[model samples]
Target chain A: MEINGKKYKAVVIGGSAGSFSVVSKILSKMSPDFPLPVIVCMHRLKHVRSGLVEGLNLKSKIKVVEPCDKDKIEGNKVYLAPSNYHLFIEFDNTFSLSTESVHNHSRPAIDYTFSSAAYTYRDKVLGIILTGANKDGANGLKDIHDKNGTTIVQDPASCDIDTMTKAALNLFEPDYILTPEKIAEYLNQLAS
Target chain B: MARFISKTVPTLSSFERGLGLGLKDVRELSAFMSDVLGIPYDHMPVSFFKRRLTNVFAKNNIRNVEHFKELLTSGDIKENIYHDFSVSITEMFRDPGFWRYLRSLLQNLSPGKTFTVWFPDASSGEEVFSFLILIAELNMLDRIKVICQHPSSRITEDIRKGILRNKNAEVNANNYIRIEGNGNFKDYYSLQDNIFVLNTYLLQNVETVTGHFLNTAINEPAGLIMFRNKMIYYDKEVSEKGIKTLTGKLSPGGLIAIGGKEKMPESTMSSFKCINEKERVFKKHGFDISWNNGN
Candidate 1:
């Protein structure tokens, strides 16, 4: 699946439950010089804050770090939403973290990141919804699609837990629906 | 190219207006709050006020701003509205790295001199309790003095007694482990009828005051002032005023820590030097250099 020569500024990936390994696989296969900022918004245990980023860093070619509040968004890096904070992509292309009440029973809610990125980046965004047990990313993926941004959902049959992908498919028609391996191939092709 | 977005989104204003809440309506409401509750709601960020008002309206089942205004003018729901507006969400040892940096800074302070710290917004006492635990762990409880201030007397009283809601236990315990490396967090508190009560012994150096830091006159200077995450609720002008008030209370060379997301207004930058820019830690200038460097 080619992007048809459209230049994208940012890529936002939202997942939950079984998405960690899928995200790790994508990141490990991504080239070191990949030129777009990748934002990962995953539902993580609020109590266990230390291990996810470190675990991702060990296998990923690109740098992965949990963003502090107001950290500038930059290319060739993977920014993970920190636990217990709802991460919003501000118009300035920097992150603003909020400790406001949780949404969809999750802080670091995928909807917040995806909607904000869609609003801020508009048609320049590429949003990908991966494996998860809940419907957290459905509205967000729809928002991206509504804003003329490219939206992708991992095929429900390919996901370990298909609830999230099925939810997205039920909500709106995404630009692409493929397995994790195909998703990585598309991302690599986009980079080139 | 990054451009500044207006702090108050247009959609919120139109939505409020559709509900019969125009600028004049908000102004009148702000005036009523100031006169009745002593809170300067006029100075709050419009977006923040709108969000809170939406919650207030939904919770109270108020039909519109006009109905809410009538209820406010009646004077029966002042306390309820105040309580709803003042409910702060905070966690213990928020940003573990900031706490670790604070620990090192406290250790570097001049030995044998009493250290003074202030919590201008001690909402629910998580931060105050977290600091007390740190001081106790360092065995410097005797050498430290803490003053906690909140707008509600009830909250102040609860904090003075070291009472905290149990909902934050898991996050607090996780942060404590990150800070301490290894230990049972239960050693510091006892469960009393489902609430976590800090050991009163650790409260020796802490005092709670019922007042608004923005309006209260504080004569004492503090070595460290914690006013984190509260500024985001205020408009630019009020945020500037609050920053000035807090900075005025700092002793020379003392440090002030703000929320990581907050930025020091350019107007106030000359008075304090950045210590940890990412953590929003700043130290007031004009103290003898040797005092910090240890000559």
Candidate 2:
């Protein structure tokens, strides 16, 4: 969407156990010129520091970093939430860090980011739930669908850890359910 | 206005620089004096405060105005500064006729199906709860949705978290029940000791959303948009833009409301058909209007 002479597209991704490989597979297929701010949240122990930033950086073509409070969302940036806090998008399209507890036992919860982005961005939002071990991103993907935004989930059979993806696919009819390569291809097409 | 001739003169820039005062401090002081005295500090500057400063400098035998900078840096003069600068502008329900007309308008609109009203500038939460009271009194609370601006999300983190403290809950609820009708507005909050935290269910039902009107349009077209007494600080250009945005966001048959003293400027006034000129309500023309950027 064009807002105030600037174009915007928001992609939000959430995953668990097999997120690193899925992220790498997707990013490897994306073209160099792909534009859009992508926010990713991966469920890990609240106390244990996540290697998500480092892990994803090795796999992605785009710049990846952990987002700080009020950091403006910019095209081509990949922002990951910290392990313990629920990340939300402020009305201004900037990331806000909240310790407002958890949903479904995940601190950097997928639902929080997905719901907040969907609410803030409206129809321009895209939500993706990938390989995980729990039903964390199911309600979130559904929330995105409810808001007239796009929702995507990795194919359950193709997912290494199928519980999260299987749960999401069964509960909500996501707009697209595909393998990692296909999901990557679709992302590249949109980003281009 | 007579220009002051200092006994021991210094150039304006030198005087300011010597005093170690930044432009922001001076601007704040100007605003404070203007607000307290109900005068335009820039156009019709206050001479008395300037003269007082001059006298203070002269009495101290300070060669340059900079020498008295200790006052601002230290405590003695800060208290005096605040004492003279505080503003007490608004009175309770300052405009009686507006309230009366609004009450009557609510009674008239009572027969409609789901008459939603939006108050976009609810600074102290009074207007949102006030509308809630009116709608609840009409037994139409279930039918109506009052979309209020979420105050916390816009500003800093501390300000966001610290807003709407528990102390005002009792009074706010009492005002709602007493003014409109008796129903426990208190039930909408959880009181632990003196801390009354608002129940999310009440907030959710009332439908408050965090949004920036400058950057985003209202999610759903509103039946009525009321932004009153909030834009007085804005100049004509800004005011016209606000009016245009509100008009564009209103539903086809919906109404637009503003403060009694506020007006749609001539440049963009044609977009609206005045419903009640004195009451500051207008009907949207429902024509294609440009979202032309407003500075």
Interface RMSD of each: 12.4, 31.1
The residue pairs in collision within model 1 are none
The lDDT for every candidate, in the order shown, is 0.78, 0.59
Q: Ten consecutive residues with minimal summed lDDT in candidate 1 chain B?
A: B1-10
**Residue-by-residue lDDT tens digits, candidate 2, B24-59:** 554565565445433333221122233234444545
lDDT of 1 by residue, B91-195 (tens): 788888878877877777677778678998777778888888888877889988999988777688889998886477887888887786334689988999999
Native contact fraction (fnat) of model 1: 0.05
Worst window of 10 by summed lDDT in candidate 1 chain A: A90-99
- TM-score for candidate 2: 0.40
**Overall local distance difference test of candidate 2:** 0.59
Candidate 2 clashing pairs, residues 3+ apart or interchain: A36-A76, B18-B66
Index of the highest-DockQ prediction: 1
